[model samples]
Target chain A: MRDRLSFYILRESPIHRMNPLTKLTLVFSLILLAFLGPVEWLAILLFTTVILPLSFLAHVGREFLSATARLLLPVIGFLFVMQSIFLPGGGTALVQVWVLDITLENVNIAFVNATRILTMISSFLLLLLTTHPSALMSDLARRGVPGPISYTVTSTLQILPQMQVKAATIMDAQRARGLETQGNLMKRIRALLPLVAPLVFGSLVDVEERAIAIEARAFNSPRQKTSLVEIDDRPIDRRIRWGLILVVIFLLGSRLWLK
Target chain B: MAQVTINNLTYTYPLTEEPALREISIEIQAGEFLAVIGANGAGKTTLCYTLSGFIPHFFRGELQGKILIDGLDTANSKLYEIVEKVGLAFQNPFNQISGSKFTVYEEIAFGLENLGLPRDEIRSRVEWILALTGIEDLAERSPYALSGGQQQKVALASILVMKPGVLVLDEPTSQLDPIGTREVFQVIRSLAHSGQTIILAEHKMEWIAEFADRVLVLDKGEIVRLGTPQQVLSDINLLSSGIGLSRYTRVAHRVNQQKLWPKGQRYPISLQEATEAFGRLLSQEGGSKK
Candidate 1:
């Protein structure tokens, strides 16, 4: 269920116990380095080496690799077919459907681009596999984010499951009205209009009623709203927090000094 | 003492052919509980909206005449001012709760904080309302995690914390079970006892009969009758044909028509009264059940 997405353990290890703010900062910094820093193949290889163990420690290394294969296979196949036929850098024409020439340059460019996308996606997915939404929000709040803003983000996260329930309720209501969602594709697609119309209308009605209820409850009336579930920063959290900060500093420092 | 006053009021829907309310007039005194009863098309909800200043203001209807709250004209009052005077607990509790807090304590504080009370004051008021509604044990628990009855109590506590002059409920306990109904009735009773004018629009007439001092029967957009509980329930002809009557009244009527016992007052509402009235017969006849 989408509700349980927050609880998935990509890997159960000591690293997962690190303070979420620390993990978040580290992941974001790594993403920045990959995207904005030098395009050295060694750096990319090093990033992948660190991420593989993290994936394995999170117990999702197999899933992580298979997912990469699933996404990259088609992209690699398309690149091969196109580059071998028309691209100027495929070394020699390996295949020609008509007048197209496949070359080594196009093959190399596609390979680099596909690898870049795959690595970025895998790293992000691994981050989600190990982090909880509530923990993430608590980290966001502690870093000077306003309570209401954080609450809005957290509640929005919490509401995804509720939206699923609302959608189910709408589907059931439509089914009761004789609109079959389980029918043939065209039939179901046509049936969707009636389903969508009421859901949107009912959601709008709920939004108004909810707004009135919110007004009555005086949600925006208070200047400061306190969070109930406070996250504890253990010693494990502290060490990881410090370690992540040091790595960010060293990487950026080396980038300038080595230059 | 009239917490709410209506004078020669008429409201028609924006595009409808007929008026939703026609020259309706009534005065609800402070601390008095009034129940509005009607069929599906009786305009019970419309009348509440009209008095609360939602009609013509929120709903954009044709309004003629005046509706007042403690002598303040509601026709042109801002919604916030109206909300200060009248707190409406809408029909559905789930849709009525707006905050995303887990605890009932936070929910109760919602309105007081809106009133711009100091943090200490908000804390005290939240604590007071929590105990007042007997939901202190539920303070830490998530409201979305509660049952219908508990959720309704949270909703009531949330509104009651504001201490509005009048509380308007639109079938608040309709979706609740019998036990939940009893819990809601207790809250309403406490609110009324504290001198808050409570307006209950409900279909459950038996509890309403026991709780409210007065009744207003609306039929097809017109105020058919309005009076004290006894005055409304004692009318045999009016009670039978009226759109909404407590189930007990119809049963009492059935028992009254049996003629097995002599009718003196001609109406019985409570189970104790029905039993006590027949106790004399049991004693006189020396009747003993096997």
Candidate 2:
């Protein structure tokens, strides 16, 4: 397992320096424009023109493309293939196979659907890569988000990796004692019980102590909490955020107007 | 003036019949280092929680009587308000980590940020605490990626940065190795010497004997003995109560029983005192032989 669950890659580019909220707004705008805009191939257009270029500007172009290929391509590819064969609204058949017909209309619709999903995932992946989770949570919390909600999001990002490490340790320990974790299905299933019990109970106890620990740090203090890292919401960031919002509104509104 | 005052305090945890602490009363002066020693289930942790305002505020227990910090009733004050006056660092350094912070520097600043301090103030305080706890080099390191000892020091620094008037430690080194335990004790010893009002629950009797201004021994859920470390740590009855004496005191007791030690002399609680007493005995024997 990866040592950490965060997608953030630290770099000194303009995109990395953008306000987290602005980047978040950009991601949401791209997604809405792709899925809800009144234009065919808008998803593919946004992927090539906006998201892909932004990834390079952020200096994570290589990582972004690899992540998209590794993580998103398979899911989108599967969806495209499955929907092309199974979706029932196509009229013109492009090819015939035994008892099934691959229709041209179905292929077109699946491509559109797949590109929309690809655009959505890749945009979000770009945001995660550029902005640190804590910085995002801090900016959100500063903008009047509830403290506990922000805390839950940030802490989960860190805790998941620690939990994975703990699980691995427990698995190794049980294996050393001759617990059959590798063989057939039943053996692996039985091995899971021993591995799971300690992790769950141990974590539950840690939760109690953790709750006390944070409270001691005044986590629930009824005061305006400040952040140590100052996330700069520059004038350019503000303009970008407003521009994204307007674009999203225009896209959605024009789609409604056209309909 | 007493910085902490507990009067006839009793507390039972939620869903439990037995009170974790019962009729416990004590007055601790400001800047005094008070050490608490007890066997398992003897309410050492419970007392630490009580002092830190967790027993009634966080645990939601059946609390009777009063605990006052700087004359502020803990039962009336909010947990946050109490936390401002008393900082608590417990065992299990891993669990004590806020987990929200990525770096050791940010982790220590977590408490200050919660208090709504300015960014510059938070930075200065965190930097100061990192140096004080001797984890300045580990400031940029991940809080999760540290040895148990380093994590424990980070935990202590996180609380210390708040500059709480009273520091409550509940067996802070219980989960550490000997090296880790010593590292933690060194920090605590320095804090004690700086005259921080500290109430530490610990099992390391030798360290307590050397550093604690007074020692309080608890049995079950009540205080059985409270006095200077020399008076309380050397008490023979503490053995029957299951609170073991320091090794020096135990050896002195054994030798006193054999009449090798001076009659009615107090048992030594530290290595330095033990060495002096033994040296005096050997010299007197040598003079007699000559």
Best-performing candidate as measured by DockQ: 2
Which stretches of candidate 2 lie above 4 Å from their native place? A1-3, B257-259
What interface RMSD does candidate 1 have?
A: 4.2
Against the true two-chain complex, what DockQ does each candidate achieve?
Answer: 0.24, 0.75
Q: Write the per-residue lDDT of candidate 1 for residues B219-255, one digit (tens) a residue.
A: 7788887887777755566544345565555666776
Model 1, A56-150: lDDT tens digits are: 87777777678667766787687666644555543554445567665555666656655555557667666666776655665676566765676
lDDT of candidate 2 over A83-197, digit per residue (tens): 8888887589998877778899889998999889889999999999999888999999999999899989989988999999899999999989988899899988989999999
Over the stretch B1-290, how does candidate 2's per-residue lDDT look in tens digits?
A: 69999999999999999989989999999999999999999999899989999878888979999999998999999999999999999999999999998889989999998999999999999988888889899998999999999999999999999999999999999899999999999999889889899999999899898899999989889999999998998888899888878889889888888888888788888999989988998899999999
Best by TM-score: 2
The clash tally of candidate 2 reads 0
As a whole number from 0 to 100, the lDDT of residue A85 in candidate 1 is: 54
Residue B20, candidate 2: Cα error in Å is 1.7
Model 1 chain A, TM-score vs. native: 0.71
